[model samples]
Target: MHKKTMTFRCLLLAALLCPLASVAQQAPATADIRDLASSPRWLTTKVYIEGAPQTDVKANYPGVVGISTWDPERNRYEFFYTDTGKSKYDNGGGGYFFITGDHKTHVLVPDVGPTKTMVRRLETLNQCEFTYSREVPRDMVENNPLVRIHVVHAPYTGTVETLSALKPGTPATP
Candidate 1:
């Protein structure tokens, strides 16, 4: 009968389209940095030392770097730098570094999951005249205080002697 044929055709079409709909629904809604660069909303800002001329250094997602100012009032490290670089939809994670007069440490905060790692490759970029350091809050570095430095985009990096070591803020003796 024509009615039977019509019903069968309609059912077949629905079955074929169902999988396509599901696949499209499963695709991630958010875009990556490469995609963001193409959008008109994408904006980048540079951070500068109070007295030094701004440098080419930039703070991209998962790449925030700065120095830890001693907060006498709070008795804690006050991070003074630029933005956190998180997306509007989700809070993108990053790393941090703590640079003291003698040493540097690295910390990684992942966007997802429960694991945190610390790194120790605190090398100075002599050519760029920049130093790097890192630290993890006591809560993050509890069980495993030692962070592995095998990956890129760790959470934090710090430097000694403030931004003065790099330029106009102060004379670079070293």
Candidate 2:
């Protein structure tokens, strides 16, 4: 039993460390996940491959806005967006995301289907602007080195203005 337990522990440690080892060898990314993760302002304006459309989100949603509000309790970023490409915009939504050990260079975005994980790496994050590039399987050929996403901050609206006037703990009207 002792031998079996020791073997199991070794396997578990290897399972964790190998993935992180690769991330550690990589260079630092300019964008801090902390900055993008906390703000409610990110609006996904375009998702493309150099000049071509790359994802369905771009095809379906004309003004595809993404919003993230910091969840102080969870310690993870929650993604919100205009639902399924129908875009009256900013109805307040939620989503899931995962990050790697380095907290830079790599980001795991939940894909549209089960068992499929879309991997995005940081390209550029200039102030409120952000760009992430996706990785596709090697069997697929492409001119673009990256499948990219572009985002800029959502402009403050009347709702935002009203919310600003509220006291710290006060909730804005629905």
Candidate 3:
């Protein structure tokens, strides 16, 4: 029984460490984003947009707009957006960074449309109203490198101002 237990522990350690080792060695690719999303341990970031303030409540904030996952490694945030063609733009694709309520955590948003309209919209706001959750018990999504936020406003509003009034997101440094 003791021998079996020791062998099991060693195997578990290896199972965890091998992935980390490989991640550290190479920058993530497009396929990696898909893999991470499909992983049983994938994380989901809850997106929100500001809505009409309720006269009934002193402070009313809108709920999540959408949810999406990205790489959880802090150093790898840029890769998730840059590596995936989903985020590309004609004038050199880049991303936007929005800090959360804590003033420490950040979310990287990529342009989801044909023009820089999304970028222009992000410029209007000041505070990001997004949040995330993790599925795996062993991992965390907070303060980690999350990328590729595709803001979706239902019913196809032609104007970005119609979305929310939370805060603007800064463009990721080239």
Candidate 4:
């Protein structure tokens, strides 16, 4: 083929593949929660008040915790976060959020299926509470993946923006 013809064909092919490349680069979809044996790596996050100083928030925030199973053959593990707050300030039932180590993808674990819910402190910020008990046993800690759970609080404004600052793979400075 002529040089000009080859160049034109290459440009066309590049343009055709650009969209596919972009889609592949996009963030992956939320992970489908599986019902595996109870995982002992459960964790909870500290509640940050609406007007509390950022310094206080960071100091109290419980950062990512590692998750793994005791059996060396086990490949996947699970952790749970229960969002059972019913603050009058909450417009709708807040859902629990979990982030992976990549710090980009997050999954909004809903209040459906096997999840047990609770409501408390209807008057205070922690008016609602629930349990996401992990029953599976595994290694306490080691070469395990870290997960960050962000429990949705009432007055859901800025909650996501704040959580974004706390990367899932990074530990909170105490």
Please give, for residues 18-118, the per-residue lDDT of candidate 2 as tens digits.
46546332325544555554444455666554345454345533332454343223333334434432212122222234344454343322212232223
- Residues 1-174, candidate 1: write the lDDT tens digits: 643454355445444543443422121322121221122121223322212334433432223443222222222122223343222111222222222222222222222223332233333322122223233322233565532211112223322222211223322211
CA lDDT, candidate 3, residue 114 = 34
Pick the winner on lDDT between candidates 1 and 3.
Answer: 1
Ranking of models by TM-score: 2, 1, 3, 4
Whichever of 3 and 4 has more TM-score, that candidate is 3
Q: Which candidate do you rate higher for lDDT, 1 or 4?
A: 1
Q: Please, what is the TM-score per model?
A: 0.21, 0.42, 0.19, 0.18
Q: Which ten residues in a row have the lowest lDDT in candidate 1?
A: 35-44
**What's the lDDT of the predicted structure labeled candidate 2?**
0.39
Per-residue CA lDDT of candidate 3, range 1-174, in tens? 643454355445444444443422222221122222232111122232223122211111111222222333321222212112132232223333333222222333433333221111221111122222211111124565533322222221122121111224633321
Tell how far residue 52 is off in model 2, in angstroms: 6.6
In candidate 2, which residue pairs clash? none
lDDT of 2 at 86: 26
Deviation from native of the Cα of residue 57 in model 2, angstroms: 9.3
- Name model 2 segments beyond 4 Å from true: 1-30, 51-57, 60-65, 68-75, 83-98, 101-104, 109-116, 136-174
